[model samples]
Target: MEMQRIMEFPDRIMDKRPRKKPRLTWDMHPPPQPQPPIPPPKVLPTTYHNQEVVNGVAPNHAYPSLFFRGLTRNGSPPWRPDDKDGHYVFAVGDSLTPRYRIIGKMGEGTFGQVLECFDNEKKEAVAIKVVRSINKYREAAMIEIDVLMRLARHDINGARCVQIRNWFDYRNHICIVFEKLGPSLYDFLRKNSYRSFPIDLVREFGRQLLESVAFMHDLCLIHTDLKPENILLVSSEFIKVPDYKFLSRAMKDGSYFKNLPKSSAIKLIDFGSTTFQHQDHSYVVSTRHYRAPEVILGIGWNYPCDLWSVGCILVELCSGEALFQTHENLEHLAMMERVLGPLPPHMIVRADRRADKYFRRGTRLGWPDSSTSRESMRAVWKLHRLPNLIMQHVDHSAGDLIDLLQRLLRYDPAERIKAKEALRHPFFSRDPKRHGYPL
Candidate 1:
């Protein structure tokens, strides 16, 4: 389907370019966890958003015991002491409000937990993102609400992104209600044991993804986080396809079969990090694996950064793994050079002051000489180039996809393919039937 431009803005002003700052390493941040029940001697404060938790109590102020998990990991669960963290402690069958009842938990993240609730008033299921009570998260939630409202106003049909049903402030937590949808692409891949999708399926997914991205870009908005986890299928129904490899290895029950989504329709979610094209384009954005080269280099990024992320997501969908799996900036850049070839000389020339160290002399990236260990060097060297990597997993349709991916993964943002242009590429234009690929 074509992406209908909802609204258009006159030429954008890229005025605020932030100065170079120290690179923020990809630290595996955990959810807002409270301290253990008992306090030890000389307890220090764990500060966040000016709210300090000293021995589970705010400095001088006693922490409220308002957090409860709906379900526990233990097989048969029971109500336990609620947590004192900022998270809104909830339980199954508990009422979020006069109209919504918590049926189950959808998921949890750094921000807070998502609960699957039955909207008694609407007589339907909905997923509600319950934001933490901390001031920062609440502020971010407001931004997401504004962005969703803007998109909903422009996207009359709600074709490209998730639809927000409703939202409210309960106990200081910003609760956002959304239409219930299927598992994220990342969840599906993991449940399928990281099996790569059929080339035909990948094409369908790629087409829709670019279209959604185009829709966002047309509105002058950028979805900083576009990983598979943020892309949810419209339906959970699927068909089981034979997995001969699993059968060969030793199958049990339905292990020899893999589930394939019956439909490719998707909706993009997670707009908390979404930014306006004219906003400050300096701070780092996007997840570690899908981050653009310019972001890691501390160079200013714009809409093209989303395109780069789309490129990475497509690669992960095809290969059953992330394109570049590293947390450190130097190693991440080194791996990029290994897969997509060297960084563009001009890009290297314009590297941010803090990111300049990753590149040495001129455009050459210091890798083997600067690697922390032989294993790290080996990991970078083991990566196959763009075409080779595509050919490894995809047959009968590698040429068009390779050409398309190369353009999308181009080191220079200017040279990278835009979402609208990428939708017109042969990779999406061609018929799979003529190529003899599975449906």
Candidate 2:
């Protein structure tokens, strides 16, 4: 028993060896203590080369070079290259076809930019619409040109449409020349703080608009996009627009006009969306606020569509806001019901399939059950609020104006008054002794 405990020890215990600890090396030095993150490089402030004060403030950072490239040392027109990339670059002082000298940008639109220019040959100021050099815009511009050309051939004395002086292709763009005009009716409204135009003014505008629209319809052309913005004053004397920026600032101020002019000559402009009477147009042609019910119902529309738009325009002139003030089709339909009474059952039944979602089945006049529909119903119930609203902004003697609006705004296109007939409406035939013959 004393022969030592080693005699009985297992062979596995003798074979086992002691483990050794891992040694630390320079390569494994705790990832170099994660050296403090290097600070980011500071961005230098951008300095504009032609920086100058404009309206007592620094020029727009987006267009600092706009002033430097478009003027000569003596502040005169300067010629620039005609082409940029695949499009035309119309500079402030560029020569267009050696006939007109660019003065400045008058305004811009979906099809093109209108430039105020001096017609060197004609010895008068004119407007040149430089259409964007794209296929769709070019096609639209050509259609406008064709319409204007046809219009010019008529040469009726009282035609209230703009005349196209000339048109030619330059640098892949269709450049159309027109008589220089004043601000738009929309601008006039803006200058007047969105206040309703005087009753006399409203009548005169309505007459002019009717005359123009009637003339267009007679010629089998429909102005699909008629609005305040497309109606322009015939003279700049009424509103002095020194430059686009000045006009913009004046519009923003809302006090541009201290007193309303007794009258201003207006001409219908922008025929890019005009169509032939026989053509089937897209339902979404007119501006949403002024769109006709027939168009909204997806039923076929005709010349009467323009009459509906005229009603809307007249309402805006008298109320300082859109008659329907809605974009959604259902809400628009609801507002129409509130103001004009529910659409006729025949109209609702014959409407495009899309309209069923707005109407209740088997009901002569019922809106859907929804939050918006309920709110619209409540609005209809409280429509008495409109009397005070109308009185506050509209200084017009109501007289036969309401009747004329109703005739023009009827849901049935056939029931809508024709432009020629509207010209003879009692609204326009007010007693000369009382209203002074509305210009």
Cα RMSD of all models vs. native, in order, equals 13.2, 27.1
Which candidate has the highest lDDT of all? 1
Provide the lowest-lDDT 10-residue window in model 2.
Answer: 1-10
C-alpha lDDT of all candidate models, in order: 0.74, 0.65
lDDT of 2 at 112: 64
Model 2 root mean square deviation, Cα atoms: 27.1
The residue pairs found clashing in candidate 2 are none
Model 1, position 146, has a per-residue lDDT of 73
Model 2 agreement with the true structure over 318-344: per-residue lDDT tens digits: 766666665577777777776777688
Tens digits of per-residue lDDT for model 1, 124-149: 77788888888889888878877877
- For model 2 the TM-score comes to 0.72
